[model samples]
Target: MLCLTGPTRAVTIDPPVLLAPMEGITDRIFRSLIAPHGGLGAAVSEFIRITVAPTPQRVCRRDLGPPIGVPVALQLMTPDDSHLAASVANAERAGAAWVDLNFGCPAPVVFSKCAGSALLAHPERIARIVATAAAATGLPVTAKMRAGISSPAHLRELVAAAAEAGAAAITLHARLRITSYDEPATWAWLAEARDALARCARPVPLIGNGGIETAADIVRMRAETGVDAVMVGRAALADPFIFRTAAGGPAPTVAEASAWALGYLDAIGSGSPKAKQLVRYWRCAGMLADPAQRQALLRGPTPAIAGFFTSLVPAGPAPPATRTSG
Candidate 1:
């Protein structure tokens, strides 16, 4: 747990931590595999790109059967205002618990459309989009964003625009649109976001994302950045159980991870699509293993990877990698 200093820190969201939506990762199967793991309180679906036409409910489902135990923010990505509003309504009609706008994706396709981080320079436009989505859905609406398009600064003005526009919460990914994963997370930006929100009349919870991988990062983030919580993406893909450990839930063993991994692959099915998704996913699961062991598994096939996990996990309560506890 993080110690308090200066003024008291409060988080309105429960579990306080959340799993981030990643392309190909954090999909429906991945979410179902990890959602019941005890620590995660919220979920965000992979970006549902909005077009001039309404997104089909079949596509909106994205294989999410139902809200198992928690609320899910169906993230809609688009540059069109009317389409965005329509998309949010369509998502809610299809059983969305919350609506999230994607102003954070830095993908080439997202850039070609001038959505996502491209709107960072246009705070007024971002505000207009948030307001439109919120009014359209009449449900809890949130947004995820990078600091800026070209500059690493501007979190102050950006966050206030989001808050005043009626976002129930906002997540700052702490990087510029052009910044890559090799860059360290600008945690100071989160501090800036907190201060900016504090000055707003409608200050909402600030959830920090980017570069939060280890259990230590989670604690330090809450204590140092003044964020209500942290969001995990690639690291969670490497170790799904990291969420449980970082948020004070019982940790899963190697044997457990092995079983879950096998089950997830099975659930995705054995078609060509399964093989394609599995290979890409296996590369990520290497992050679950220790450094000394990661490369071998990264190079090996699924059976070898599964065998490695089975051999390592003892037939007893597993010692967790994280120190976080309830």
Candidate 2:
């Protein structure tokens, strides 16, 4: 276990289980909703794309706001080393407890611009990027990378370079960029990455990602790979309580969980149509405790929906759905 002291208190993460910084998913609203569930050691900010143009203050405010009562790491994606370093500094100034370099995003638009997973093809560049960001931000710097470029050999090189770059930690998503969500994650590959990191003798922690859904899955992965941590992404969206379960805490009653979700929507405010739209999307995606209640909330104007979802608290788990994944 590593203990890091922040401005407010000391934060300890042992075999750290983290929340992935997924775009459009882990915003302030969601982070606040899930933080209280307990088990997660860190929540990463959504990837902030750094550009040659000057960053707007509001952009920083929106992305790098105050910590959500939990250790929050800011993530940045950019092809330029200097630009990323500057962005990391700005995030630190804005109150980021840690920094994450995103080299695992597989979006075609991102790769087309030579950002994100495209950097996987250049292990040397990946090392340079990690070195630059780590040097720029005195805080712990981590990197998230894909399994490899086109072959498993590439992943070995990637892990070696990241270790050489002084990364405080590294996470492998267990699949190549071209592999879509439909395919099962290659658990063996993740094991290989862990072994590679171990052989390097770097003291940095290694985290495994991809295909983890339940607490059982986490336990299995840790036992199999001997990694320092496991990251939960879509599974968290399905059930924020997974963290609690992983930590061996009592699961929140359905009503209690619903109330928490409502509180999150309330925090975001329902006064604006845009805010309402975001809430509605979250509701339809089964984020709310009660699906029927969420629909009824949307019956009136946007504000009404916000009010309803915010005030809802059913007595038990919502009706079983045809499909569920967390």
Candidate 3:
């Protein structure tokens, strides 16, 4: 277990497995499901775009409210430094424990606006943005970034600038802006980042992300990259029980897992049309271990789908059709 002192207080992070702030995947329903698993140090919400105007009070109340007692960080993506600063202040007022600047999302739509990975090309702008956001919120600030724009040469400079601008920590995805899910993650890049971070004059914890799929993988990544923590993105979707397994805690039975899903549906209400779509998208992201089971659950009628997931527990053998794909 490693304890890092944030702006507020020391946060004890064991095993240091974090749930990445995936846009569609890290909603309240999923955060509730994954928090009880025990190995997670922090859970970040999906990136909220900070616009020129302030976020509406009602929307902020609904979206930024605490999902759980665990340290919840609010992620914001914006090209405008002033706008991003306003969003960070709003997030703090709305009860965010930390503010995370997103500079790693590869979405073309986001990059076109000079946000996300596009910030990588201008390290000075990144420093200014980080400084503004960190100053706006007295809370600890962090940044999630790609390895580099197109080469490793610029990554160290970006990290150094973020740290200089008051970022409490940095999470490196260990891939370039153009590296998609199709390409395998290069673990060596994480090691190089670790070395670079160590050379920085100030102390900043480096968190490794990408291609971590299991408890074992977390251990391996920590050993290989020498990072303070491992952030699980697609893998958490594959098995929400990963943190629990890594902590040597009991894994939820299949029935228990299903019941957890049912609870989420109940809390959110499946009556909404979007609820059904959420079920399909969440399962497809790799939360279900069995492919056949996942398909069966998704294809079934609403009531059937709810019942199927509610009845599963952790004891069963892998569903025969289980195949790993992101």
Candidate 4:
């Protein structure tokens, strides 16, 4: 287990691999659906914006979900610290294990609002926002950031600001905001940030994110950068069993994959547009091999698609150890 400790809070994140919070994805239902599959240390909520006013407590509770099984960290994004403390209090009451500040999102809308990665250009603002959240809640406060805005010139200051402001842990995405997602993440930057955090008075954990797609990548990242943990984002969309695979567990069989797809469909309800979109991303669907044939099945009505997934499952006893009680 990896423990992220700060002055007033400590969170034990087992497996040391987390699910990156993706906007428009990784919602409560998505998290619940993936939780049964093993290998997650924790799952982060998509950032809950605290803009002109504090987010209501019910919204925080819905975003955080019930604190069962995998611990969920509520992520917050804002241009300034205006409603940070109030939002943090709502998160605490909502049962968030920890809180994460967003400084890595590259969306133009968020950046235009002076939120998300826009804050990467202002290290002092990040410090103030983090400090506000830290003081408002006993829950461990963390920060997620990219290397910088246009360059890595102020990367050290960004890391130092969050750490000095009492952040329990910091996750570095290892790419400048101007860089495209297709560009290779700079592992050297992770190493640089690791070195910077080591110089902090408290030395909070550093989580390496971006461009990690396989179990081998996870191992290589830790060996190369000395990050305390790793976080997986888009990769999990393709392979829900990624965490288990990274932990050296057996890969899910075709039958197991079929079962999961079918279960996911059931959870989202039959004929859901969401299921159609997300199903296209699953590795199991890739089993179809032929693009034309795959599209034929994927585009069909929900019932037909469900039947196709069911056909993939050979008649047999159900898979074992698919879900953890926790």
Candidate 5:
């Protein structure tokens, strides 16, 4: 178990696998669906942008919902530190276990506004944001960041800034802002960040992210980067059982996968068009490899799509649909 020291208490994450925040993907409904599979130590909400005003408690509650299965860290992002502390307070009131600042998002919409990875170019601003959040609440304050915005020259400085500013833990995505997801993540940089954190007066845990897919990848990342934990994003969407499989657990049976898909459909509501789009990811990765089956799933009616998934299960009583929380 990995113990993260919060201001008021320590949070222990067994298995040490956290769900990384993905913009359109890791919403409340998705978090609930993934909870039953069992592999994560914690989960992070999608980056909630705090602009001119403090984020409302309603917004935080909508994103966080009621704590379902695991502690969910409320992640916030902003172009400046104006309302960061207030936002953190709102998150605390809304039931966040801890808080994480987003300095690693690479989307152009977020970057164009000087938030997310754009903050990577300004270590001072990152420090101020972390300091504001650390002062605002008793929750463990963490920062998620890339190596740098456009270059690696300021990597150590950025890491040092957050660490020195009182961040309890740091998650390194290990890719520069300019890099594409297709590019290989430089695990070597994660090692460098680890070394820099060790030099701090109070060395905190480091979480390594990016390019993690299979159980083997999780093993390799921990061995190579020496991070206290590992976070998976895209991989989790493709395979909800990733955390389970990483821990040497068996992959889901066809019926089990079908039940997972149906439960997710129920959570999103059968009418959502998104329900049709998500089936591609909701299935265990590569389970729908047949071209005909893939097309059938996409072209089928939304309500009837559940039947297609059910067909994949063997002849027997259907697996019970797992209940999902909003």
Candidate 6:
């Protein structure tokens, strides 16, 4: 486990890896299933909108559900100063290990409200919001941002601003606002941001995100960017064991992968994270069945999905154990 020793909160993060929060995914159940299997250092919740009115708080209670195995960060995305501060304090009350400000979400719906990447147009305001959250609660305050709003060149200034405002760490997703996943993430941009922090003599950590799809990509992210940590995105959903495998944890067998994926779906209950994501997961893991079989698995009942996954594994020895457990 890697310990992030911020001024107020010192969080122990195992394997120095993080899960990038996905809007519909990355809910309570998703965090529970992944952290225990290995190599999950920490995870942030899906971005919670901090509006003019306070929303109901969601906490991880021991009796109601499985405990997430890593430091849990509650993420807040908003353009309102008071709302941001208030939400951070509420997250502290909800037992969040840290509070994360989301300035990196590129969704047009989010940006339309002057939040997310839209704030990149005003770097000083970004600094102000981070400073507000840090002051509002004793909880560790971190920020996730993109390279820039329109151009990657603007990241240097924003990185410096976040550091000066006492963000415990910064996560940089290497894409401009206008770009989509169709454009490749520029790892050089992350290096540039890290170097900027270094030049300032600030030991603030940088977490790199985007464009990772394999175990080797995880290694490359840390090696090339000089980042303190990395967040796995769609790739993690595709292969739940990628974190464990990349961290030198045991390689999961076919049965184990299916088990982990099934466990994740079951924990999800019903809603938000549709079971269709599992179809993509199967494809990503190169486990495509025949056309009729794939259609049946994807479109049939939930029980069928489970049966299909289970069928992938014949009678074999159990896979390597995950380092931790729910």
Candidate with the larger TM-score of 1 and 3: 3
Q: Give a tens-digit lDDT track for model 6, residues 210-308.
A: 899887898899999899889888877778778888988877777777777667667765342367776655543456646676777667666667667
Candidate order (TM-score): 5, 4, 6, 3, 1, 2
Mind giving the per-residue lDDT tens digits that candidate 5 earns over 16-63? 989999988889888988877787789999999998799998999999
Collision pairs in model 5: none
True-structure RMSD, every candidate: 8.2, 8.5, 8.1, 4.9, 4.5, 5.5
Model 2: per-residue Cα lDDT over 238-298, one tens digit each: 6677888888887666556566656655676656444554545442224565777557656
lDDT of 6 at 268: 63
Candidate 6 Cα outliers beyond 4 Å, as residue runs:
55-66, 269-273, 283-285, 289-303, 315-326
lDDT (tens digit, per residue) of candidate 1 on 199-255: 999878788888976656777888999998788877676667777777776556556
Count clashing pairs, candidate 3.
15
List model 3 lDDT by residue over 1-326, tens digit each.
55555556455666577889997667877787778767787878888876667654455546655567577777888786866766777887887768788999889898999999999998898889888987776688889999886887887798888877878888999889988876888889888777777887876888889888677898899998898898898767656778877778776565655666667668767764434655544542245556676677667777776665655544567669967899
What ranges in model 1 sit over 4 Å off?
Answer: 1-13, 270-293, 299-326
lDDT of every model, 2 decimals: 0.73, 0.74, 0.76, 0.86, 0.86, 0.78
Which residue pairs of candidate 1 clash? Answer: none
Clashes of 2: 0
User: Estimated TM-score per prediction?
Assistant: 0.83, 0.80, 0.84, 0.91, 0.91, 0.88
lDDT ranking, high to low: 5, 4, 6, 3, 2, 1
Error of 5 at 177 (Å): 1.2
CA lDDT, candidate 4, residue 245: 81
Q: Which prediction has the highest lDDT against the true structure? A: 5
Error of 2 at 42 (Å): 0.9
Among all windows of 10 consecutive residues in model 3, the one with the lowest summed lDDT is: 277-286
